[model samples]
Target chain A: MQITTFSFKRLLIYPVILIILLVLGFTVTAEKQPAWFQQAQDEAEQDGYKLITAHEMKALYESGENFTIIDVRPEYEFREGHILHANSLEFDLGDKLELKSDKQAALIGLLGSDKKQTIIFYCRSVA
Target chain B: MGYQNVLRFPDGFFGWKSFFSDNTQSVDTIKKLGIGDVFPSCRLVMLYDETDRAYLKIQSLQKSFALEDIGNPYLYIVIYNEKCLACVDEVQSFKALYKSLNESLYLSDKVKLLAIGAGSKKRGVIAFKKENAIPYPLFADENRSIFYCLGNPVLPTSYLVHIQPDGRRQILFVQQDHINNVEMLIQKIYSLVKDMELPK
Candidate 1:
């Protein structure tokens, strides 16, 4: 009876080690991606969206067109410098769950929940 | 009716400022602050010791910190907080303006410049002042009564206060958002001072 119990404990240890290794591997893989790529990936997962370039943004501004620009960089970075009229809303790289709920809600609130309204999220750069 | 358009400046203020450079300024909006607008009485504090983070309330700041010190004829630049990019940029402009005024023989001491940070507590005010090396008296208005006084104008607004000889103060000019042109602002202040008939 004691031998059987010892055998069961031994069996559980291998699976637990494997599970931890798997989690660590996934975490490393996620961290390996560039910040912009990760942000894009997370954004796509939340809602289909494309990254914007500075020049394109400049053109848009010059045209006097209306669009919502949200700066998802850190507040200090935004405070140091940002595009004119951009609102600073920092994105948590660690908080994936919040990306879909709180952030989305904030974005919707800023530009209205309308599907057609253009909204853009920005960091330092895509490249 | 539903709103039609919405947009973003992804490059942010940094991009806008870089694009405009010294030629032109891209501002959110400009609201005019005129004379006779009184600042609401609010709790204010100033740094007493820079080394130890000690503070003294404006009400008990010093005998010298009177109505005249608060403003009889002063440039009171009010900001929301350090997080305000426009406000930070404007503070840099104010620094430059201060340096210029100090160097100018005629305009020296023509008007005192003081900055008030509405909604900023003592710690936040101290941090901002130290970080920016703001060479002016920065007071923290925790209750934001002063902010509410001017109809809660957007961050980084400047008010030209005309303090009479009798210490009667009135708001003379208010510049909302970025000052745009430093030269133009100086000229306007000079003109305003001339109108006030204060010693130039």
Candidate 2:
């Protein structure tokens, strides 16, 4: 009986070991990919979007061009000083995660959940 | 909408020029601090975050290197620890630049190193702690008067200025990143001094 119990415990070990290895492998792979924002240009390729500077926004505004302006700063900072009519779409710094569900929903409502639009993220500085 | 060629400001008004309006200091305020002149008695200030590691590194440098009697000649070191969210290697690398500058410049009491904390996510301490940091005096400037005074808000930077005999100051050099060689900083200081007709 002791032998059978010992054999059962051993039988569960390999699967657990395999599971650990897979989880670790995936996480390590993610870390190697660099931060999310650094991948902006690459993500831009996946979906046609562009990263712009604060000065670029000024020029576009003066030109009267219609491009979506997403303000990725915090709500307080957004309120303190930001471009007029700029939709606040705060994302994580390294592909920052949106903190508020309402904010996230508002972003979807404004930009449309549609994956394609001329989305330009601008804040005090590009992370 | 009309489109303009999008590259370079073409030497027109931009961010660099905007910093000038802060009205912190004027060129005519002093005789333009020159080389061979004693370092100014300006106080050191920082807008450092209490929890930042890089800020701590710089603080450590200040504590370790602060000298009351380097005596006859000196420059002040002010570190702006405002937005110090850099990687460990990036922070560690600054020490190398500091050492290089110190070794090459024949830096005596004539040069002072000052760092300004540039950006911050929080109210007080926008800067962070990093791997290794410079050895020198550091000062804080929350409103960025010095930054606007000198107009070099670029991050991870250092500047050299000549404090003229008559107390006027002129910027001799400004370095944005490790890309700037320290030896060049020395050369600029020497030139600014020579131009000011001061003894090198």
Per TM-score, the best of the predicted structures is 1
Put down candidate 1 lDDT per residue, B1-200, tens digits, no spaces. 14333333344444445556432233233333456765443434446434212211223334234445442245445555666555776787888776765565655556666677877787888888888988766877677667656655656677777666666567787777466677777778777777778456
For each candidate, the DockQ is 0.08, 0.02
Stretches > 4 Å off in candidate 1: A1-127, B1-33, B41-43, B48-66, B69-72, B198-200
| Residue B138 in candidate 2, Cα distance off native in Å | 3.7
Off by over 4 Å in 2: A1-65, A70-117, A122-127, B1-42, B45-94, B119-134, B148-157, B165-168, B176-180, B190-200
Which DockQ-derived CAPRI band holds candidate 2?
incorrect
- Candidate 2, RMSD to the unseen true structure: 16.7
- How many residue-pair clashes does candidate 1 contain? 17
